[model samples]
Target chain A: MVEELIIAGFGGQGVMVMGQILSYAGMHEGKNVSWIPSYGPEMRGGTANCSVVVSDEPIASPIVTEPTTAIVMNRPSLDRFEPMVQPGGLLIYNSSLIDRAPERTDIRVIAVPANELGEEVGSDKVANMVVLGAYIKARGTVSFETVGQCLAEVLPARRHDLIPLNLEALKRGAELVK
Target chain B: MAGRKLFKGNEAVAEAAIRAGCRFFFGYPITPQNEIPEYMSRRLPEVGGTFVQAESEVAAINMVYGAAGAGARVMTSSSSPGISLKQEGISYLAGAQLPCLIVNMVRGGPGLGGIAPAQSDYFQATKGGGHGDYRLIVYAPASVQEMVDLTLGAYDVAERYRIPVMILGDGVLGQMMEPVSFPEGSEPENAPQRPEPEWATRGARGGRAPRIVSSIYLKPEELYKHNLRLQEQFKRAEAAETRYEEVRTDDAEVLLVAYGTTSRVCRSAVEKLRTAGVRAGLFRPITVSPFPYKALGERARQVKAVLTVEMSLGQMVDDVRIAVAGAAPVDFLGTTGGVVPKAADIVERAAALARHGAADQATREGIS
Candidate 1:
């Protein structure tokens, strides 16, 4: 099976990092994965997005024009990616920031109050992690345990102190989705 | 456990070049490819190698020439416009028969184009952008893993032929991150020393004659002989280094010919075509210069039509047509100015080509 996604948000919202973490989780589960950011000038502000592909077999293209899933953490992201989700696919957005709901009726849309939940978990810095947790719950593409293990691999030793907080964020967000 | 680590394509290439015993890197900063030199700058110092962010692309390539001349494995990388700036030096290196790695993380270009990815440099890379009759062996990697493998392999190919080798990647490949594993026993921290070349400009010893690394021949006849020698070397490389990947081409009614980023899209397209009951296959040339013409020619004999898909207007299509040699009608589908064609569209175009055999070449519209 293959799951293609776009994770989009502001430059500081950890959109690329979320995509990378998901890719790492896919790798931890012994799957082929790729993460391609919208680099250059587009990455300067709220237009930051990354395309991610996770597959049982070799991944062909890292690009996803029509993603099966979209994790939009801001309103601009919601505006940009809501319609691009394939029919019957998932659109997980941060409801704390986006006011308007996705207009598409053909897709599954999950409105997670990611910022509120991130604050509830400990820090608003983990907002992307909260969205990621919801993404894991909604898609089940990679296990939470695999994501935690991937965190160990991705987080530098100097930043190891934050792993528990991030893990708490992941768990709390997943609990919200449940 | 699988030996895998996540890496951005440019960073992976830098680490792989280190693993390949490249002790020197000289490059200028360019978007979509800056990570290469940035990684090298950090890592090379720890390994006792050199990383110089030269003043300009011209200076950087000349430094590569100097380093390669001293028998050191060296590399330089840049985006399309920067790469164009280094053409004069590249031609000089080619003429002098120096071995070095040059990376072109191609961006959209005619002059300082946008930092978005494109394969518009196809002609500039494969058709010898520099003056004089010479060709640099070009490797087009579709994945980050291939980015690592081909970066390492490019050094070997360069050294084997005493010529410059190019890794022609687009911004898409350079900026992407993927899981990759280097070869077994290729630890980058303490890379093994590569043997110094006998022809290197090392200080003369043991009463041996001093070697001259010169590309200038005063006489026309002498220059003609030198050109012939270079051509012979190129021919040898063509015979030995024509690498390609053919997927599901045995009974395909249509063949999609692509390289680099475009090839990856075509691979996805092939899967879609199969689901739609279309007999489509892909012929991806790993070496863009020694371009798997023979293999493509053989596949062309079996396929009803050949569709050349690229991120450019249609540069590589000329080579595809030459390889197909009228065995099958050749068609083209591509974009330019950094707009990438979608895989679904590639499938649709190929399927139409499969059904209709071949449409008029002039009727094909460029995907914006």
Candidate 2:
């Protein structure tokens, strides 16, 4: 199985951390994965995104032209990436931040209220985790346990104190999407 | 696999240098490659290695010269514009025959182009970015794993040949994260008992004749001889290390040539073309300087046409044309200013070349 994904949001929205966790989870699951961020100047106050792949086969190009799944957490991200989803693919958007809906009918669209779910769980800053949780539950690329462990690994030691809240946020996201 | 984990290419390159026994790092910070110096700053001290964040790129490269002259396994890294600043120092390193690794995680530009990935520096990297007739062993890695492997290999090759070596990557690879591991089993170390090279400067013990590490040959006659000697050594290095990798070429009708990040795109294009029944293949030159010219020339004879792709406007294709040299028709495709070439684009070009390159060329000639 191959899942080419583009996860996008604001710079401080933990978009890069989301990519790192997924890629780390993919690695721990014995899959060939790669994650590349949009590190250009366009990232200043713009949609910060990253391309990630989880595949059973060895990956060739890390650049994703048309992603099989585009998990966008903000309106700018949705506006930019909504058209780049492959036909018959998945488009998961955070309904909390994006007011408008995705117009593409060719692909599956899931609207996850990540910010609302994060606030209910603990903090709204875990909104990125909520969307990531929705992605994993929808795609089933990696196991929930692996993703949790990778989340801990991706975050520094000081952030380890917040694992429980993060896990709860992830669980809320997973349940919301399905 | 015990130590395998996802690492950014720049951080991995720094760690790989440490594992390769590099004792010193000299560098200044730049975007897309800033992690290299940053990682070195934090990690080098832990391993008893010195990390100098030089005031400027010029100072950093010259510091590399000083460390290498003392026979330290040393290195420095920078992006496009910073690398441009270090060109004169690189030339001096070559002129003096000092062995040190230089990592160029190339970003866009003729000037401060962009903090986006590009292979536009191909000409500067393989064909002497500095001045003079000196050459560097340039390795262009296609992946983060290859970045680690080539970085380890680059130091060894540099020391063996007493020449500058460059790991020519791009911002994409440098900023990307992928699972990478150190070489399997324990890598043998350069023991403390390892004898210093005959040319290394050290305290005078037992009154051995002092050796000088100067590139200046005052007399034109001496400079001429030195240039000849440098050329002869380069030829030997070329013979010893001209590496490339070929895939799906056994019955290929069209061949694609690329390196570094673009090579991975071409590899995907090869697979896609095969699915479309084009019989496409990829020829990736791992060592872009001592480029696998003869090997590519031989493979060119087996194909109907050759297409060279790059992130620049046809730099490496100059080398490709030299290698293919009348064997087959050569075509070129490129993107500029950090725009990545798509795999679909490559497939279309290769398919057209395999299907109607000859007929199309003939028809156009007839019409004209």
Candidate 3:
């Protein structure tokens, strides 16, 4: 089965990084994977997004017009992407930034107070990890252990000192579903 | 050997150059192609190679000229406008018969166009970018993995031909991430060492005088002979290097011809046509110059019609017409200024061409 996900937000919100982490984990698990970002001026201060496809078969188009899952980090992202999520798909939104809830009943909407969770975990930057945690808990496309390992490999390369805090944020967010 | 790693196309090209034994890189920063220089900056030093961000594209390409003159495997990269600035240097390198790799990760253009991907530079690349009769072997890569493979092949072709080669790609191909295999072993041992240039400005040895390399020939006859020699080299390249791919064209009634990213779109179009029971196929030219004329000419003799798709208004379409040589009717479909045509549009265009062909045949029968 093909599992397609889109991560979108402002340029600096780590939305692209979240997609990269998932793509890395998918590759690490030996699944066929592809990561494609919108290039050119769209990547400036404007909204930016990336499509990640993980599948048992070869991927046809790396550009996903309809995604099965979406992680919206901001209000603009939610408004832009909410209509494109497939039926019965999952959407994890950062409720701290996105004030409106999704209007659709055909999909699963998980609103995580990602920024507040990050603040509770001692950093506001780990909000992406919090949203990622809620996504895993909701969909189970990838195991929490694999995501943790991906986090260990990718996060330290960018921010070595924030790993433990980000890990804590992930666990806290994941436990919210339980 | 079986593992995967995430890499942008620009980074993949840089790494592939290193694996191909390119020891010197000179480039300036420009949108879409900046990653190439950045990758070279971080990776060159680790490999004990040289990477320099020159002050301008002009300077960068001349530095490539200097390095290539010294018998070193070298490369230079830029985007559309920057590549225009380097045209003079490229022409000189071509005139001097220097072997080097030049990369253009193309962005939209005319002036300082937006940083979106475009294929508008096809004419500049395939038709001798500068004011001379010289040609650089130009390769258009569709994906990030082919970006690596083509970059490596470009260097090898340049060395083999003793002429400059260009890797012509769009920004989407430059920025997308894909898995690439890092080739095993150190650099190949059998590459021809840069010949000691009697024409290079190497430091004077003992009593020997410094050498000079220039393309300026004042005498009209002398310059004419130089042009003829360049033409001869181009002919050799034409005979030796035409690379292309023909997909399911055996019984194809309509040929969807394209290159680079446009070729990928045409592949999807062909699949759509197939599902609809239309006999459509794709012909993709990997080497733009050394233009694959013979292959297209042969296909034209068999196909009823050909549709040329490109991101530009119709640059390669002109080449396609020339290749077909009146053997078949050639049609053109294109998008410009960074707009990419969707697969559905291409398929629809192909279907229209098929209907037009059938109508034309019916008219011929009515006349008979």
TM-score of chain A of each: 0.95, 0.96, 0.92
Off by over 4 Å in 3: A40-46, A66-68, A83-92, A103-113, A116-124, A134-143, A156-161, A164-178, B186-212, B365-368
Which lDDT values do the candidates have, in the order given?
Answer: 0.90, 0.90, 0.83
Please give the DockQ score of every candidate, comma-separated: 0.80, 0.77, 0.41
Cα error, residue B51 of model 3, in Å, equals 2.1
CAPRI tier for the interface of model 1: medium
The worst-scoring run of ten residues by lDDT in candidate 1 chain B lies at B359-368
Residue B348, model 2: lDDT of 91
- TM, every model: 0.96, 0.96, 0.88
Winner by TM-score between candidate 3 and candidate 2: 2
- Give lDDT: candidate 1, residue B173: 90
Candidate 2 docks with a DockQ of 0.77
- Stretches of candidate 2 exceeding 4 Å from the true structure: A42-45, B184-193, B358-368
Can you write out model 3's per-residue Cα lDDT over A14-130, one digit (the tens) per residue?
A: 888788888777777777777877764665468888888887665544556568998898899899899999899888888998888889899988889999998998987888888
Question: What is the lDDT for A161 in model 2?
Answer: 91
**In order, how many clashes per candidate?**
0, 0, 0
